[model samples]
Target chain A: MAEVRVENVSRSFGAHKALDDVSIAFPDGGFYALLGPSGSGKTTLLRQIAGFDFPDSGRIVIDGKGVERVPVEKRRIGMVFQNYALFPNMSVTDNVAFGLSVRGVSRAEIAGEVQRALDLVQLGGLGERRPHQLSGGQRQRVALARAIVIRPQVLLLDEPLSALDKALRVDMQVELKRIQREVGITTIFVTHDQEEALTMSDRIGILREGRLVQEGSPEEIYDHPVSEFAATFLGDANILRGEATETGIRLGDGTEIATRLNSMVRMTGKVSCAVRPERITILPASAAASTTGNRLAGRVSKRIFAGDSSTYFVERDGQTIKVLVQNAGQIPFDEGQDIVLTWSPESTVLIRT
Target chain B: MTSAQAARKGIRPALPLLAPAYLWLTVAIFLPLSAMAFFSFMTDLPMAGREWSLTLKNYAAFFSTSLYLTLLWSSLRLGLEVTAWCLVIGFPAAYVLAKVLKGRAREAIFLLVILPFWSNGLVRIFSWAMVLREGGILDTALNAVLPFTVSIDLMYSYPAVIIGLVHSYVPYMVLTCYLTLQAIDDSLIEAARSLGASRRQVLRRLILPLAMPGIVAGAVLIFVPVVGSFMEPRILGGRTGTFYGTVIEDQFVAVFNWPLGAALSFILLAVVLLILAASAPILRRAQQ
Candidate 1:
């Protein structure tokens, strides 16, 4: 396993810059996720690390050695594509043994390694089948086995689980995490799905428009997104426009919300308040008077029961904000009913607009 | 009505839609072929403008003649060579056209590749004759720099026939291979590269295997035409122009032996069918 370091990498096609001055270092034996939407340079970055593409202006080092001149095969990086591009002509055993065979390993060793790789992916007895005979999940596992069988320095997966159905995707995600841990290979997984990134990654690097917007643990990304884009992209957030003052910012409806601000930050500026849906609590009118912190009087515009939880669309000051309440008991309110939305000072994050 | 009767009624109304093309094929193709087969079994008229009789003399004569057998073998050999050459040159050109060029550039290149086929075959052969003859354009171009005499007589030879056949059939081979290569998903190569296969490995393992169907189809197309071709060898092969096609033409024109010509034509058809049948299983396996 090798640590991968990308320094000031930039790539462009004509006028469209796919990656621009992006730099990141992945430590040895950790799962790093490059999380971003489509056209956000996640795949480009992964391809560069795999030595499939060269950066226009930067250097990449694997295990403290510069790999700019090394060819893809010599770099010894294994990659799993999104489509699980297994060789249709080869059986599963031959597909997994392709790398070893190309590198001139002995036939006896190849047979043993192929079987071990197949067994690692939970497909011990399926070496004779073609890719078309396998399901989407099975094909993806075959692709994974083929990638890791040679014990590459780095393992790169470009949205590998995106092709499977939801149930299969979840199962494969758990399997992938287990396999990665077992192998202890430095892996870089590129995915746009926040849930997948959060679940599988040791550290998630959220990218936007070819730039790293935030890099942190899943909880940090969820609870402490530094920008409006980061907060909105990671999860649904109710954004309230406000202004910063000595005590707190005044909402558009002239309601004063008490908030704690960093002392270093100036108070004379426009700010936005972000709150998660589940963080806001809906209370009865009798309990509204006793509530503290930020409270707003609103009417339930729409209430939807989504199996395990009930979602309330509360309209406050001409803005509809969503509040998710667990369906442990009866719903707190019905559609078009008046209710008080309450949240603690800590729940509302003050972000610069 | 009964259910069976209702179903028969439903089927009866749509049968006319399939009739016209089948009738045309039967009358235009199968009927003539059957007539030719029947005539091949008949004896040729002893004198000009005479009548026909039931005899296997034509077939017997074709197998008995050493000259005719040699010509048949030579034609089949030339056909194989032309097909092999077309494939060797056409596959890479088609690959470049389909995978490297894009948009209007690809279309432009394809058009250029196919442009030779748009001209009449007689005109194309005459043009090649001009280039291959002594003191022709090719000789003149070579003589400009070389001190030695560049005018060698190249017009009437086996090489000339093979060259003409390849030139005529290369575009068809390229088109077949291009369509096959174009249909292959590029992601397959990308996947191979990401899996640590080099560029040469990608071409050998992914491209050649996937394009095998088109290669086989092109080979069949080029081989069938070159083997049965009379015009190229007649114009280009002067003394060496004694191919199976020339003999078939001779029986019809010079000898006025329709029965013998028909028998020779049937033999050639059988040879082509045999080759196709022999290759089908191999091609099918390659595709799988």
Candidate 2:
């Protein structure tokens, strides 16, 4: 268990830059997730930290020691690839024992360690089966067992749960978090799924075009996004683009939505106000007078029932905003009905575009 | 008849589609093999230039001759030697071609490997003869560099036969191995390395096991063809290069003893089949 610090790391393949001076630090015994879309250099950054790839510029340090010159085998980094990469020719026991055997561990020790690793992943007594004989989730667990059996300082996982179905993925996510907590190993998980990052990571580093855009806890990132990209990528947020004024930002429709001028808007000419769908409350036209705070007169454009919650698409001044209401025995409103939408000022975040 | 009954009475739908393939297989493959098997059991009439009667005398004559047994042993030894040599050289080359080369470079290298096969086998042997003969290219080149006169009669020898067979069959080994190597996922090797395996460990534990199928397949292909080859031993094998294939050729073409030749051919067939059967278990285990 060691802290991994990457400083100004950049990598390029010919003219196409894969990583652009990305830098982030993962503390010891914490789960750090590099979250981004495809081609966003999250995997590249993870590989660089794993010693599989060398940065063109800058340094990667683990526990205050430079690891750039270290070979992947010598780096002692445990990596679980997206494809699992289990040795298909070997049985599960042999696969898990590979790292220990390579390090010249005794046969008796290897047997005990292999069994322990298998049990850690809830796959005890499956050592005799080959990778092809296992299901996707089982194979991934085998891969995890193989990686963690070595007990390296840093555990690198590159989209390990991406191959499983939704239900299995959720189950495995919980299992992975439990294993990490039990072992207390410093783990870096690379993924594109926002929900997985939010659920599993102690700190989520959101990357965009090979750059580290934001790094914070899940709640911090989701509630206080510093940029429009970060806010939109984390989840669905209503972004109202407007030009800043002395009073408040004026919308394109000449309607001025009053807001407390934030430091971000003062520095940047353009600003975007983001509000979560659930934060916005919808009131009937007849009960519009009863609502308080930032209110907008709109008509319900669309209504959808999502089991426990109902979503209303409200249109105001040619802008469509989604409002989510919990199903608590309230009569559902019909589409095209007039309503007043209101939200608290604290829930709205001002972002610079 | 009613329309439905007429339709039912027509020819089977799949028969016409399969007819041409079955006809070709019978004419081109089965008929020749059946003739060869039939001739092995018959007594040859030299006067009539054909077989006279069915008999086991030909097979009996095979075990009775020590000279025939020696030649058969020589053929087996040469085939095994050539196959081993091809595997040693071709496996590494195939590994590089499959894992290292990419795009146009890979295609270019593959083409270079196959280019030699486009030329005739006899032509390649003749070219080797020019290099290996006394006062030939190799001898002349050695004489120029050394003070003593270097004259090695290498054109007709067991080594020459092995060399020729290896050269002829190496491309086949490389191609088969390359296909197998290409099918392996590269991430498996990376995973092995990240798991604390050294370079040698990775190759021995991961690569060699995965590539065993191709290696076995190449060995069988090279060994089978070299054992049955007549032209290489005749052209390159001198006094020491005499093999079972040449003796079988002599019985059929030179001495006009078709019964003895058929018997010798059957012995060769049995030997080859025995080898294949013996190696089948090893091949199956390697693949698994």
Candidate 3:
């Protein structure tokens, strides 16, 4: 519904800076996720946007209007807390209608709108029940319905699906995306779960140590992480730190694993390349001496089978590289056996660090 | 014993473990209440030499006595006034203690609020006389500070009774409300504000409704005791403190009317029960 832009925001608690000169522009009607580890200032950024906490020196603009002077009550934002803080004293209907009721909307309109919101959440006909009567997933839906009922320009969700169990969380994630799509509200969600951020958001911003480390589409960031921290944090990446050469970086053992150098990296100094486990294929060393294209020889130290796919830990030059192989009819690699690992140049991400 | 057999034989140790407490409560509470109810129906104490009978005369006497009714009304009004004042003063104090104060300061301040309850209640009431009576600490302190000398005689008055009662009961309100208010998630308030509920609206719709159980518990704890309080009014209110409780005290001690006292106490019990029953639904919802 509206674009939210946070510009040059810096906030501190005592000596510790929670957010440091962080800037990100959330485009209109796009579901953007702020992803970071704990104490990385992702939640702090979300709270600043919601007007719950003000930045020490920054500008937060919502719908092209600067909101530094406006309080949360007058800012017309909607928020879903991690706990789904529905008004326990109110029925589900009343909880959904709370924003409208506070704004002095008519009773008839509030009832209709509340019902519509509940229906949008697929929780219609349960408005008379109190919050305690609802299950955890139901409470989550109610929290979402309550937030969007007032048609807020920006919806803020702070780890909303973190409380639900795995199955329920997966189900609600789809439900949440559907509701956000239907409403077309500019939603900014704060979550530390990498899979949830990657699967849910249109754009993902990764925060580290109070700074925005990377902001891009999930695929872009995953496939072309600019820093070692981003590559390792966003997903599991086997980082190969070595000296840069004309084509790629050479490991300490003189194994030149050639990879495409992204624009972020200059081939003049030491660099690192992150190769995902699933991107590499494992082959017996006897069958791999003649092959080229980023190959490594190692003994399989550990093999983890998970029915459909298997993860093989390959030890090469005192370092372990993980290779994931889909389970078809091929013979599984045994632990302690010599294996050859190979991945294409495009799958390897050249890290700036 | 095997675990299965031990489970099947659940009452082996549990009953004996709980017997002492149940016995004490029965002797200390239930038996006396039953005796009081019985006494309310008797014409006189059942002395072996005297002939006594179960009668409705005491109940009838309460219905007929205009003086008793007026005193009961006075006591009810006193309870209401004291409860209101305690809430007005206590809720904000509780809010500050629970929400505003932090770390070691909150614990220290909370202890300070409850410090008076550590001392004897009667001593505390009598101490107020020194502050409220003419030529007392208040009079001396005020006269010393003011340019014009002034009399500070607040003793032997209705407000004096309210002050003492409020002073005695305010901690109950604060303690209960602090627990509930502190338990409230901070996110709920933030969520309400983000949804465009102003500070006042947040307090009215979210905070107050969520804290109702504590408020109700405090009101009940204060109102019940204050309604039956004879010592506080006697010490602080002086002659103007002839409440229903004081009148009942007169029946037992001054008038030597045991049956009438029992009846009055029973009527007050009924009133307390009625009040609790009236608010049970609201309190139940709040607890949920």
Candidate 4:
């Protein structure tokens, strides 16, 4: 039940800075996800928090104690690696008991606690089996059980479900969330998968090029992304670069898209606007004869039929605009059919850059 | 296909490929072993114009003679000591080469560790004689650094034999251990540390067990050969190196007791087999 606060942490490899002046405070008992692309320094920041690697500058405070210089063994952090890293020489029970055994727990108590941990992970009857004998998902659960056995102040997971297949990954994600809620440990998970981050974490910090570009709850971030990178990277967003006006941005084709966000932007300069794909509704031009909020007319270039939903790619002024619509029992708008795209002004996000 | 036909089909391609190697082993190993067994049961070598007969006398002689039994124990202890020293020195060297060093530096240093194996074993052992003999390199070096005269005579001693054997076989330990140690994932160590395992705990609980196969392989390679070794003991041990191996050598080279020597050799082979069988389960677990 400890909170981890990374303060002004900066680390560099030679002249290339991997993490630069990043500061973030994780609330106690919160499931936080450090989401980023490869080489974006999410793993580096996680390592700094875990004490696997030290930051060249700045302090790391865990549970109100500055421990940037402390080694991992003394920091009392449990970690589940990407590959699980279950000790091959040990059986499933032994792997789970490792942390407690290292802390000099009694044998009778270790056996009981190990069994309880295994039961907690729902691996009740698999004590004697080696790590190689278990399935990928089973190994992941054992890893989780092992990390929580000693009841560390904080738990770190480095791409915990990345090695599992799609179905198992989803299953494990739900299971992971349930276990973390049960333990109520301050857990920090690092991953490159955006869906995993969005679905599993209470709070997410999106990083880009060694800097924290955005940090908020999933709903907060999804509904309002400040930068163009966050807008496109977190989810599908249509971006239009044009001249800023009192209403919004005027496109090259003289189409003015209204943006509802207004706090931090220039009054009269070039600006960009972002609109999510799912927020827009597409209708055939023959049936689209209404004046509403933020309307645009374009020809449908392509339509993809996924089982429950279909994405329509519409071409408007040399740009392809993507719109996701739920599939009703009707044929989608055909190719070369003129369509009108409409979304409320609340769905439109104004980007400062 | 039916089960019998499928089994036949699987064997058809493999039999031809496996025949040459098995045939070579039968000719080179089994035939000689059979011949040695036959000679061990004989009272004398069936040389030209010599009387010979089958007897259990050589085996009886080995059991009845205390010198032979004592020397056998001595040779076994020598093998154990040498294997222990090799492991003590070699495992850390292997770990450094495999984990600590990286890139081309690892490759170059690993080659340097294995470079001695490229030279002749006899020459290497004899070179140790130069270092261990009275008033030799070691004595001279120690004397030059001290204010008093020093008599560092280590030649013709049991420790000299162990030193020479360890020098000749430590590379085997380093090579085998390096292969397995390098395959250990770096993340396992970090995972252990994250679970609050100290450095010694991680090494004992994770690394030593994981590298057990390589350690066993290196032990078998060094111990089996050192148990039957005559040259290393003779070259470096001189007079005090009168081990069971040297006694076996004497039967063929000096004593003219071929049947007895073959019987002794068979007994040593039995001891080596027993040691291997004792450690087989451990080796199997390490491999898994």
Candidate 5:
């Protein structure tokens, strides 16, 4: 296992810049996720790390060595493609043994290593079946086993679980995390699903328009997004645009809202504050006189009753403020009912407009 | 209705759609085959001017004659050699066309590969004869480039026959192999490379196995025809061309023994069927 670093990488295809000055340090034994929407260059950076594509101008350092010019076979990096890419001609045993056999390992050694890898993926007795005979999730396990059996310096996964159905995807997510921990290989996975990044990685780097937008722990980026794009993209955040004040911002209706003091964005003439939906509490309008912190009076425009929690859309001065409240057997507020939305200042993040 | 009856009803509509093609095939292929099989059992043609009797002498002659067996063995060998050459020359061309060349260039080259079919097969054989003869284009070109005098006469030989057959049929190999190679996902190749497989290893382990269907399909197409091809051998091989097909032609045309010819043709059909049956399992597995 080794720390992989991308320093000032930029790549372009024709006139389109796929990755621009992107840099991230994936630490040793840490699970890192490159999260982004389509066309955000997340897959580009993964390919660069895997040595499938060279960066136009940058250095990719793996295990304290510069390997920008190294070919994929020489890189000793195992990659699992989005489609799993299991060789259809080979049985499960041969598929897992491919890396070792190609490297000229002995037959006895390959047999043992392939068995061990298959067992690691919890497919111990399924060595004789071909790829078409196996289920989709089983194919994924075979692909993973095939990659890791070579004992690569780092494991690269390009949206490997994206092909699975929802239930299987969640199961594989936990299963994948277990395998990564068991093997302790420094791994980087690319995903567009923010929840997968949040649930799986120790660190997340969100990309936008071929640029790195934010890189930090999932909790850190989630709680304190630096820009409006990051705020809305990573999770649901009610954004309020207004004039900047000493603490937070004043809404266009002249209502003052307090924000966290340690926000990354500097207070300026114009700024926006991102308040998470779950952080706000919805109460009757008559009860607003007793509460403290940032508060707004609005009618509940809509209420969505989920199993564990409920989301209330409150319209205040022509702007809808979303408030999430846990379902605790209390009578839910109806639409068109007057309500007050209140949250602590620490829950609000001041984002650069 | 019962499910079986329902299934029969479901097929009823498609029968109208399928009739014309099946009828054409029965008339064009099966009727002649049936007639030949019947004639192979007779001693002579059943015409008003001749007395004919049902006999197994036609088939008996095929097994009793060592010359016929030798010719059949030689024909099978010819088929094997031509198919091997086509595979050697065609598979790489297919790989380059499918994977290396891009959109417009790939299409243009593919057109060139199949362009041999636009002209007549006889024209193609004659053209190869012109190229391979003693003082033809090949000989002249080699003599012009050489530092010493070389005879360079390859016409009227086994090699010339193999060359003509391979040239006439290589496009089938390339077309079949190209389709299967193109259908292979690019990521599978990338995945193999990432697993530390070199280019040669990828070809041997992944590509060749995955393309078995196309290779088998191409082999069947080229081999079946090349084994039965009397024209190219007659045009190119001269005296060396007397294989099973030429002997069969002699029985019908030169020797005027239609019953023996029918028996020989049926034997050839049986041999071809046996080969196809042997490869059917491999082709089916490859497709899966």
Candidate 6:
């Protein structure tokens, strides 16, 4: 419903800085995820946008209005905590109706709104049950329903699906995306799970050590990570360190691996190229290599079969390269067998560090 | 079988482990209560060279006498007043201890709250006497600050008795309420605030409802004792302290009528039990 922008926000607790000069804009009606490891300030940034805590220096604007100093209750932001935090003393109906009742909505209107909100979350007839009576997934729905029923300007979720089991978490992720789309509210989701962020958000901001390391579409960041940390943290990547050359980088073993040298990197000194595991094709060493792509000949030291795909750990010049091959009725490669790995120049991202 | 039934059966193996506590209760509590019940139905104490017989005269006397009933009513009123004051003063103190203060500061303040228990109850009551009596510490402090001279004679008054009882029992309220308040998750408060509930609304709608068990517990702890309290009223109330407890004490020590004293004590116990039974539903609901 509204664009929320955090600009140059810095917050400190005693000697430790929780958030350091972090800024990210959540566009109107867009689902943005703040992803980071623990203590990386993703939750801190979310709290700042929610107005739970004020930044030492910065401005938080909602709908073009300065609101960094406004208290949480008046900011019109709804948050679902990691634990769901449903009021155990009240039934599900009262829990969803809490926001409307607090704002002094009419009694009849509150009832209608609560029912609609519950139905939106696909929990239509669970109004009479207490929080303790509901299952883990049901409580999550009630928590979501409670937040969005108030029609907040922005919805903030802090690791909302972390409490559910894996299967339930996957189901709720889809359900959550559907509800957000249906409501058409700008939502800021904070999570440490990289897969959840990549699968759920329109734009993902990766944070580390109180700084925004990368922010872009999930595919953009995945395809072109600026640094080794971004490449490795966002997904699995095999980094090959080498000396930069005109066309590519020459590895320590005197083998030149081709790279496109995108604008993010310059070929003048030592560099690293990140190749995704799934992007590399594994071929028997006896077969002829492809005419125009980076290739590495190595022996398969280990192979992991995970139902539908296999991950082969290839050893070349004392460095391990991983290649993911889908299980498609081809005879699996055995350990200690020689293989040639090939990936296109565009799939290999060159990084300066 | 249902889990509850399974659980009940599971407790059977531990029944032997519970014997010592049950034995201690039987010897220390139940036996004395049974003796008292027997004495309340007697015509007189069967002492050396004394006559005794079973009779309903003790029960008849209690029902027929207006003075006894009136004093019982007044004692119940006193208990209610003392409990109300303790709650009004202790709940906020508990909230501060549980939610506001943290770390060593919280521990230090909590020590201060329960510090009264470290001293003897009589000593604490007598200390209040020193503060409330005319020309006492409070009087001197007030007279030193006020522009006009006024007598600060609060001793031997109803408010003096109420104040003394509340002081002696407020820690019970604070300790009980603090335990429950501290168990509330901080995120619940944040969730309520994020939902546009003001501070006052959060307290009323969330905190109060969640802490009801503690309030009910503290009220029981304070009310039951204050109803039968003779020391606080006798020490603080002076001539105005002629409630059911003092009268029962008089029958035993001054009148030398054991039968009447025992009868009076039984009636008081019955009244307390009736009140507790009446509020059992509310207490059960609060726990849920």
Each model's RMSD to truth, in Å?
3.2, 4.3, 2.9, 2.2, 2.7, 1.9
Regions more than 4 Å wrong, model 5: A263-265, A288-290, B1-14, B17-19, B63-65, B139-153, B277-288
Candidate 1 residue pairs in backbone clash: none
In model 5, pairs of residues that clash are none
TM-score of B-chain for each predicted structure, in order: 0.91, 0.88, 0.91, 0.93, 0.94, 0.94
Candidate 4: misplaced stretches above 4 Å? A265-268, A286-290, B1-8, B279-288
lDDT of 2 by residue, A7-46 (tens): 9999998898989998888999999999999999999999
True contact recovery of candidate 6:
0.90
Q: Pick the candidate with the highest DockQ.
A: 6
Worst 10 residues of 3 chain B by lDDT: B279-288
What's the TM-score, to 2 decimals, of chain B in model 4? 0.93
| lDDT (Cα, tens digit) per residue for candidate 3, span A1-353 | 89999999999999999999998999999999999999999999888888878999989999999996688898878899999988877889989999999999999999999999999999998989999999999999999999999999999999999999999999999999999998999999999999999999999999999999999999999998988999999999999989988888899889887887567536668888999999998888888466667888899999998999988889989999988888897988788998788888888877777
lDDT of 3 at A79: 93
lDDT of 4 by residue, A1-353 (tens): 89899999999999999999999999999999999999999999999998999999999999999999999999989899999999988999989999989899999999999999999999999999999999999999999999999998999999999999999999999999999999999999999998998999999999998999999999988889988988888888999888898888788888888888577645578878899999998867766466588988999999898999999899998999999989887777898998889898889888877
Error of 1 at B260 (Å): 1.0
**How much of the true A–B contact set does each candidate keep?**
0.62, 0.83, 0.92, 0.87, 0.85, 0.90
Candidate 6, B1-288: lDDT as tens digits:
898988878988787999899999999999988888898889888899988999889878988979999999999999999999999999999999999999999999999998999999899889999999999988988999999877778899888899999999999999999999999999999999999999999999999989998999999999998998898899999999778888899888999888889989998998999999999998887655
lDDT of each: 0.87, 0.88, 0.91, 0.91, 0.93, 0.92
Candidate scoring better on lDDT of 2 and 3: 3
- CA-RMSD of model 5: 2.7
Model 2 TM-score is 0.93
DockQ-based CAPRI category assigned to the predicted complex of candidate 5: medium
Task: State the displacement of the C-alpha of residue B91, model 2, in Å, after optimal TM-score superposition.
Answer: 1.0
Q: For residues A1-353, what per-residue lDDT tens digits would candidate 5 score against the true structure?
A: 99999999999999999999998999999999999999999999999999999999999999999999999999989999999999888889998999999999999999999999999999999999999999989999999999999999999999999999999999999999999999999999999999999999999999998999999999999998999999999999999999999878999999999989963536789889999999998888888386779998899989898899999888989988888889899999999999888899999888888
After superposition on all CA atoms, how large is the RMSD of candidate 6? 1.9
- The interface RMSD values of the models, given in order, are 1.8, 1.2, 1.8, 1.7, 1.8, 1.4
